[model samples]
Target: MPKFFNTAGPCQSDIHYTLPTGDRLPQLEKLIAQRNYFVIHAPRQTGKTTAMLTLAQELTASGAYTAVLLSLEVGAVFPHDPGAAERAILDEWKQSIKFRLPENLYPPEWPDTNAGSMIGTLLSNWAKKASRPLVVFLDEIEALSDETLISVLRQLRSGYPNRPQGFPHSLALIGMRDVRDYKIAGGGSQRLNSSSPFNIKVESLTLQNFSLADVKNLYKQHTEATGQIFTPEAIERAFYLTDGQPWLVNAIARQATEVLAPDVATPITVDLINQAKEILIQRQDTHLDSLAERLREDRVKAVMQPILAGQDLPNVPNDDIQYLVDLGLCKIDNGQGLEIANPIYQEVLPRVLSYTTNASMGRIESRWLSDKGELMPMELLEAFLGFWKQHGEPLFKSTPYPEIAPHIVLMAFLHRVVNGGGTIEREYAIGSGRMDICLHYGKVILAMELKVWREGKRDPLDEGLQQLDKYLSGLNLDTGWLVIFDRRPDLLPLSDRTTTEIATSPAGRSIIVIRG
Candidate 1:
């Protein structure tokens, strides 16, 4: 029984290759020892459950406290009914404690209580009768919304004053978001204007993703156990693509080792990691698919729309931006600006947003492809112009985000071209004012830049040519295209405004300038 990379659930030490729990989070012994209640949050599958579960077991084993991690997720079905939710949640707690603790440490029988207060009552009685101090880690704390969420928070806060004598010595609320972001009611309303009921928490801490060093160490364990080698380049590439997100780190390794190169004698290389990444993105694994689902969320879209289009974030609420960060959709890069969390997410987000339009383009004629399957830049340009004249406006209505409909529709068209045998890599960021695409097919590569001319903005041809010149130099390509999507309200119809011309970049590269 050799250990393997785990992506499905909490890692089990004997069965999964994992970093030390102590390395993943700050020392909490002092807080628990002092009877402090705190919040622990992180994105889904980043090992919050594993860390807290292992910590609870280790603390109970130390003989100084009775500890266990339980979940409120099972109670989510009763979101509006606090009494039922509490009863269901308490039952799970009793079962967990019985399984995790010795008979001497088991909680006493529950008290008969009316309606919604059973959660607090049960905790108080359990703490009072325990041989040692009791510590509880409440997992999935965000599942309850509205009245149920408020009720649970207030109950936990009320029990804070009676610690070690009438209530648990320490309690931790664990979830994917900080308590303030929790929705307090229906209709997409958040807790923006209200004071939290669980205001007793001393600190709101987050479980961070693994670091590069942690990733290297975790992968090295697999080599040790199975004699399979992950090349240094592959390890760094995985970290770059996933940004050390726990599930993604494990998933990429699992896909490479288990599916792509199962033989221990076959060493994993950078190319294998890239192939594994494509497989993961195409398969839409549970982890990636769940994240893609958030692209349609209003809060998520508000922040993501601009980043995807290389525009500035304006008028978007700070809480909404933080919500995206908390969910691991985006990050404030180096305090410089907001960007997608990682490279893989950068790829996945646009592809998911353009899925419908991309799919609608069926059996695309390979006019831009040579007999050897190589791409031709001029052929691609002609094809795009013809497509824009015929179908661009109709497909614009098919895009997911209105702010970047032109970009999305364009990507959808390119996806059709790349879907056959090529790859399209995208690079865009907040305030860049343009999106860049590098299309690869066979031995041929095409570079392009996209800019939008909105109302009150000047023509972007000059700026676009200058930017494309810099971009072409980086790719060492002698020619590229600059597409300025004129989305001004006063513009003529799509058929009448679409046209193209040739120009020279500042660096003397041939630049194809398209205005549509």
Candidate 2:
């Protein structure tokens, strides 16, 4: 039986495996033949190392080239000292080859050299001895110092002409960021020439999570191995919670098969996936830790804040957006907007950001009175506005996440309304304008979009109308509310602001407009 769940690096012959599902494999295979220097990057735990190792084996087995997967991550542990970095890498190279290759083929001893020049020397020596074209897969390349990176790139450039004979024919640098975007501190700003050291990269590839079909294939692997069947509904539920992220996909299936439904006769259902998701989130594993770490950066916040506020983001540079996308924190939505990359991220980001504020917000979770047990949308808005009027100035002065205060207040209000009866689903990112809050009561859904009104703006009515229209359309709801917060005190006459119910949006969908 094949070992199906692999969390470490790529799966070996004895371990379980899932066939590559995304766009990366074909691209890597093409690069292997073309002898390109390129990058493979994605969120942590997305199986990058595993995929590269697997690809290397495939290339070697074909007898067309000699492939080796080398890790530079150990160099990172030594800081920027090139000498130490070189020694560590040489040590790792020896160990990796010893473990992966036949004993007779392993190098007996590595040549001594300064760290800055060791990599180039090592590669040149290895290439001289090998008969076939050498393909080097350098994993965790980002962990090396900027100077080391520049040196490495230059060495590759200096040795390219010797490829297919005297040097590695194909080189792949794998890490969290693309090779071009990597800003190696202290390294001279020499633009990398595609034609030189590692030119002719067929493409830069990112490993994506499993698709719904991929998710089913994963579960099918377990069933084939253990004879445990997962109900179709359970599969759908797993997709809904994990959005087909590779780690989460494997995790959910593993939990269900091993813990939730170990017996083949027992049916794995939707509830089991949901239960597994909750368990995973609460555990806050390394996957979650890596994602949360990105949130602390100003760049990430700048992009995510507007999404939480439900406002349109001003045009940001393509490079900035692409950087975040590469980090797996956000994605371009249908080429129209940006959205959190996955359900788990969508669920956890806000909670992680609101951990401190949610406590105070929780205080008002059930403060309002609604006899029908429904959130009185207009009433809740008015109550929040009234509080904002009296305490807004001071609260803004003290709030840590002030950029998202209005949204937080709204969440606090909703938390009060749905305290005992319903749940709120929030979607917001720093730069993605517009926050989506879905309040659910059993089967009924109440959706609201929150926006911030800038000074001198014409009430933001046109923009608000357009956003509400899109929100309602997406939810397939005929009517919903647009709550606009006027940040400027000059426009504030608290009592005169009105809440009007409109029949049709200027764009033509019926929406309720509530201004405060």
Backbone clashes for every candidate come to 0, 20
The TM-score that candidate 1 achieves is 0.97
Task: Please estimate how well model 2 matches the true structure, expressed as its whole-model Cα lDDT.
Answer: 0.69
lDDT score, residue 244, model 2? 74
lDDT of 1 by residue, 287-326 (tens): 8889999998887888899898899888987888888989
| lDDT values, one for every candidate | 0.88, 0.69
Q: lDDT per residue, candidate 2, 254-304, as tens digits?
A: 777667776777778887877676666656677787888777666677777
> CA lDDT of 93 in candidate 1?
78
Highest-TM-score candidate: 1
Candidate 2 wrong stretches, greater than 4 Å: 1-17, 20-24, 62-64, 186-202, 240-243, 258-263, 281-283, 359-401, 412-422, 427-433, 441-446, 460-482, 490-516
